[model samples]
Target: MNPKWWKESIVYQIYPISFMDSNGDGKGDLRGIISKLDYLQELGVDVIWVCPIYKSPNHDNGYDISDYCDIMKEFGTMDDFDRLLQNMHARGMKLMMDLVLNHTSHEHPWFVESRASKDNPKRDFYIWRKGKNGGPPNNWESYFSGSVWELDPQTDEYYLHLYSKYQPDLNWDNPAVIDKLHEMVHWWLKKGVDGFRFDAIAHIVKKEGYPDAHNPSGATTVRAYDMFSNLENVHTLLQNLYDKVLFHYDIMTVGETSGLGPEQALDYVGDGRRELNMTFQFEHMNLDAASPGSGRWDVVPWKLTDLKQIISNWQTVLHGRGWNANYLCNHDQPRSVSRFGNDLYYRIPSAKMLATFIHMLEGTPYIYQGEEIGMTNIALESIDDYRDVETLNYYEEKRQQGVPEEEIMSAIHRKSRDNARTPMQWEDAHEGGFTTGTPWLRVNSNYAEINAANAVKDPDSIYHYYKKLIELRKKHKVIVYGEYGLLLPDHPEIYAYIRTLEDQRLLVILNFFDKEPVFELPADMKQGGMQLLLSNYQAPKNDDLTQLKLRPYEARIYLQQLEGK
Candidate 1:
């Protein structure tokens, strides 16, 4: 196994706008993050992946970048960013910036010039096609809802935007565009940035001939996943990116591959592939949809068996082939404890259980902001309380389709991105100690009980459990490079696995439900001396593993020394 620092590192994602607010501006700034370096250092993370802080119109919460080289004014100036980087490096932590290379904001100078006139030098910077049938070039749907094409009356043409219309897709086929993006990446590397988390990377290359996707359900718009995701040419583009820029810098790169599976993922991050270090696959993230291929908003009860299958597939497929980026939730997904764990009844044990599952997996584990303290999803009273563009668009679309307001609100409560976008609960003070001024989004009403201040003080808090998990990873190579094996694969409530690295072995047993489940250990697996490594609940009095009854939302880890070591 390759021994890289990032491979063994734990990543903590920081959505800057909601992380911390400095100067009472109702927004998180670089200075705010600077003040909390000690806090993160205490959490024992090796790398911090801060979301986009570049110049943007806030149309997509900083994802729509208007300037790659400049910092968003609300996030503070370039000097503040420099100071933030300096402080992070001083404290032995690395910084990973979010790179949105697939598209640029419409207000960007290149796009502005591209839309000016057909003969302009930058006219080819963005994908543009003449309108067909007096409508969009294709019936493809925007990821945020509505048509992917936006008509520009100036030149009687339409531009392709896989996301919001303000975020126009860049023409990667154009060499000048590729060159400019590569230069921007080099500039950041020169500025001492350690790595990049590429956003919407699989959608960078579009299929040949803007073909209309077949909508079997006959919806007005269709998600043309095959047309824009993981195209044959994307690998070539990524190779060029790696050879020209990323290869020179010792940096970590993880691509957000939305519509990819484990087999296809190998093409991007395989041992010899020069594309990326790892990929954030969405297969497991989509298991809760109402049906196959249904969008995230169409919620359904997720099965433990299905989750186990998905995770086991990824783990086994990428064990020695490629790398995996293990995560349950991020800025785009709902909180993990609320979605997968019993947030109300067993929040503490469930949160630790989920943490143990991910941290013990064969990959670099990412802790979304506030996840360590067991943050739960927030349900705003009305749609107006939400601020995410995706949530608002879904709400309007469903409302126009005659769906009742209550039904739409219920779906939003379950799946809206804003649930993860709320300001971090720092304390029980005003606005969860996120800001002295009005927060951009409403703080969760339960913040008084679930703030980080209380978690830090309590030794048994989820925050400390996460700290211990990270420390264990640092001390044991088995957690990082151990080969993974699934146990009790068909069990309904127990998700168990074994990690083996030569003579050392670790067994992890998790109870996925709110009821106690009995797990029977196979006779062949009981030949070693077992030692309790960790557990969410108190250690059981009996060390026998023959027929163990696990508590609700319980998690246990055991280390075995074969032949008395």
Candidate 2:
């Protein structure tokens, strides 16, 4: 394996607007983050990956950037950002900023200038094409619904926006656009930013021809992203990016990878490759997503075996070639404990169990903000509670299609991006101690009981447990470099894996559901030098090594042999 600081580092993601609110403006800002730098350092993370705090229209939250150089007014001035970076570096933690290069907010200067007239200097900076038969440029559907093309009456042309009309896709094929992107990146790198997490990196380069995507789902517009995502030119663009800017800086680059399978992932991220340090894979999360023969809106219940299979596949496939970013949840996904574990019944142990499921894997683990506190998904009373554009758009589209409100809400509750965007639960006080005033989004009602203040006070809390887990990664090279092998691939309720490196062996077993699962030691693991390294239970009793019983949502990490031998 190629040795790198990123490989041994633990990354923590902070969704800025929800991380902490320094002022009473109801939104989390850079000052708020600065206030919590020590808390994050104490959490033992080596890097802090803050989601876009760039100037945005908030159409898609901070993902839709309006300016590359400026900070959003709500997030404070550039000076505040400078302080945050300084605080992180002083704490021995690196800072990674979000780089949304593939698209920009409609209000961005480039888009504004491009939309002015067809012959404008920046006209080709964005993807703009004349309407075909008075409709959109193509039949491609926007991720937020409707057609991907939005018509500009002044120019009488349609601009491509894969996400939302407020966010126009940049024309990566244009030379000037590529030059501008390089300048922006170099500008940030020179500003002392450690690295960047390129957003929608896979969708940057579209196929050469503006082809109409087939309506695979028989929807009003084409929803298949094949015509635009993971295209042949994306690799070229990334490599070019690496050469133009990334090569100069000693920085980490993790792409927000999508629309690609496990094998295709290697071309973007591998040892000695110039493209990226790592990329987030969706196959593990997509196991609960729409599968073959399922409807477009279908959300399936993931089988534990399938989740283990996909993760193990990545681990084995990318073992020595590329690095994987192990995560069970993120800013865009629902709470891991709520989705994969029994959140309502066994929230604490299940949260710890879920953390073990990913944290101990043979990859760099990312702990999403608030995930360490066992935060459950928000149970909103109505649609008005959600602020995510995608969630609201999907709801309106479904409602107009005669879908029942309750059914739509059920899906929204299960998959809404806002679930993870809820303000951090700092204390048991009102607004979850996130803000002095009302929060931008509703805090999870359970925060009164699941706040960080309470967790910090409890020695065995999930917060302390995660701290230990991260510290373990710092101490155990075996966890980072050891080869991974699934122990119970076929087990439906237990996630068992063993990591081996020369003379060291580590066993990780997590009971996913809220029912006790009998975890008998496998025949191959009968050798008895196992010392329990960590357990979620208050008191772990291991009378018989061969025949072991695990409580509901129990998680245990065992050191296979004693220290020296």
Candidate 3:
């Protein structure tokens, strides 16, 4: 395997709006991010993948870009961004900006002109189609909760929007649009930006024609992802992007490819593919959904076996064929500790255990903002406390469907994106020290117990555990490049795997639930000469590896030496 900076580095994802607030505006800005450089450096992360800071109308937060060339005023001036980049580079950390090219805000000049008149030069820049039967062009559903098509009054045509109607989909088939996007990418690269995390990249290329989905009744807002995800032309477009611009810069790129399996992912991130360094696959993220056809709001109890299978499949398939971007939570998902671990009684142990699982995996581990401190989900009493468009839209849609108010609220509590968008818990002070003014979103009510200040002060806190995990990854090449092998594959509550690189082997045992499960070594495995590499709990006095009982959310990593090597 070849060595690359991105492959060996740890990425920290920051939702800038919720990260910090330097001014009293209640919104986190570039200057606010600049203020936290020391704290990020202390976390031992090599790259900071910030969510969109582009100029936007804030319909879908910053994902709906109005101006590609300018920074959002709420985020701060371009000068502040330049300083942010400089400071990150000074601290030996790279900055990866979120690139939302699949769509642009309806307020964008191109979209504005496109919607103005039929003969507008920029009309073809966006996907505009005539209505089929006094309704939207087709029965496609918006990701947020509505028809994908929105009728424009002036043009008397419907424009495609996979997300919110405020975010109009761009026409990737148009050469002019492609040229404009490429130019903008180069503009950022020339400004010394390190890399980009492509948002909704898989949805860039749609089906050959605007085909209607199989849904006869388009009342429900359920998306047929196959209609516009991971199309063949996407690879061609990405290859062109690589040849024209990305080839000139030594930078990293990861696509938000939600619908790709391991084999399909190779088309984008495989070695020498000239498309991307890696891509974020959503297979693991969707395991907790109630059913295959169910929406995200229909949450269910996820099993440890299923998680192991999904993760193992990705790891084993992408071992050397492509690369993986390992993560459990991000800006669009709920907190990992709250969703995947026990955030009530076993918050610290489970958080540490989750960190161990991610870092020990064979990929570049991405740590979301509050993840290092074991931040959990917020259960606001009313739906009014939520600020995420997705959550709000779901609430309204369910209410109209006659779903019980309590059930809707419960689902929101479990699956709302706002759970991850809360202000960073910097301290236990007002608004968790994120800002002196009111926060754009409510702070997690548990901030008093989960703030970063407390974590930093305590040696045994999740923050320190994360810092130690990162340090181990830096010291042990096996953690980054090793081949993964699943152990105890059928174990209900224990998730265990071994990473092997040459003579070095690392055995990772994790108790996924709050049960004391006995983990017995397999027959073929040797137990001699094993050294405890790291553990969330204290080192056990006994060296017997044949059988051991695990504590609730306990995680252990042991280094074993081959006989004579």
Query: Going through the candidates in order, what is the number of backbone clashes in each?
Result: 0, 0, 0
Tens-place lDDT digits, model 1, residues 219-332: 768988889999999999999999999999999999999877899999999998899999999988988888766788998888999999999999999998999899999999
The deviation in Å at residue 194 for candidate 3 is 1.0
For residue 111, model 1's alpha carbon misses the true position, in angstroms, by 0.6
Q: Rank the candidates by TM-score, best first.
A: 1, 3, 2
Per-residue alpha-carbon lDDT of candidate 3 for residues 229-299, written as tens digits (9 for 90 to 100): 99999999999999999999999899999877898999999888999999999888888888875778997
Model 1 pairs in collision: none
TM per prediction? 0.99, 0.97, 0.98
lDDT of 2 by residue, 1-565 (tens): 4668989999899999999998899999999999998888888899899999999988888889999999999999999999988888988999999889889999999989999988999999999888887777788877788998898889788898989999999998899999999999999999999999999988987767788776666765876677887887888888898998899988988988876766788998876668998899987777777775233247977798888888888999998889888898999899988988878778888999889878899888999999999987886979998999989998998999899999999898888999899999999897999999989899888878999899989998999999889888888888999899988789889888888887889999888887777888877677757878888997787646577788889888888763556
Q: lDDT of all the models against the reference?
A: 0.93, 0.87, 0.91
Query: What's model 2's TM-score?
Result: 0.97
What is candidate 3's CA lDDT for residue 42? 96
Q: After superposition, how far is residue 472 of candidate 3 from its true place, in Å?
A: 0.6
